[model samples]
Target: MTDGQITLTGIRAHANHGVLASERELGQTFSVDVSLDVDMDTVCDDLTHAVNYALVAQRVLDVLMGEPVNLIETLAGRIADAVLAISPRISSVQVTVHKPHAPVGVALDDVAVTCRKDAE
Candidate 1:
């Protein structure tokens, strides 16, 4: 990460997304963390040059709250794409999504997936 690189992290409320009937009816909350790597040299003169964590968080919330997804993986992908679309300065992105209330039979703490991408 560079000197002024930034990361955005938060938990979002999402609808249930599983083949199971019960999961479909009830929604749950999922946690998401996004790391954005950017070249801040151009924006060094102004704070705006740096990635705004608040904007990132709001964007993530918009995706999660606006759309109904079948899987957290898809949500993560959409988020990563959204971030890159919004900030061309972002050179790379790492997104991690956590589902704490997965419908697993056995006792488990949480389920999560991480995706790393380089800007095109």
Candidate 2:
């Protein structure tokens, strides 16, 4: 099998997830980025030999819009897990969850957590 990487960036969703009650009650926007390492054998010619990224993105969105979690770190981990579960060809995945309006009491552009998972 040959190794290759696929990346998806700037995925955005709205959810209520945080330590503070207000964060959960009011909800906010979240951004996600995903990168996957895969093994393929198509010489870059066949969709049948490659991962279907549209499906992958939908899975990530499902996680984003599904359950509520307390931390972006956990969200990142879940996304990594979800992507890795999609196909055996996916050898590893990295997910980044971004919180643009984190309730830190300080001004910031964004707060994010990144997680990675590998097949065992």
Candidate 3:
């Protein structure tokens, strides 16, 4: 494994993911951050030898908008799985799901869930 990582941060999307009925009715903005451990030792002079971050972002967005989940934990897991499926060269992946407009009735900055997975 090479000591290199590709990070995609601040990916904003609108999704209905929460326990409250209002949350599912009126979707809110969500932010996603992903980091993939990749092998930088590979010989490359083109994008083919590296992970396409645009495709990675789209994969995350696809899962975010695909279905409604009640918890950010589940969403985080799905994102990790999706990224891990992208390529075998990816040794590990970390995914974070941010919920800024939580209905906790408390004044808070944001709530988020992070998940990490390693290739088997």
Of the candidates shown, which would achieve the greatest lDDT relative to the real structure? Answer: 3
lDDT against the true structure, each candidate: 0.77, 0.90, 0.90
lDDT of 1 by residue, 20-91 (tens): 677677877778888988877653566566677688888877787766667778878888888887777788
lDDT computed for candidate 2: 0.90
* Steric clash pairs (candidate 2): none
Q: How does each model score on TM-score? A: 0.84, 0.94, 0.94
Off by over 4 Å in 1: 1-4, 42-45
Q: Is candidate 1 or candidate 2 better by TM-score?
A: 2
Enumerate residue pairs that collide in model 3: none
Q: With candidate 2 superimposed using the best TM-score fit, by how many Å does residue 110's alpha carbon deviate from the native?
A: 0.7
Report lDDT (Cα) of residue 64, candidate 1. 70
| Best-to-worst TM-score order | 3, 2, 1
Over all chains combined, what TM-score does candidate 2 have?
0.94
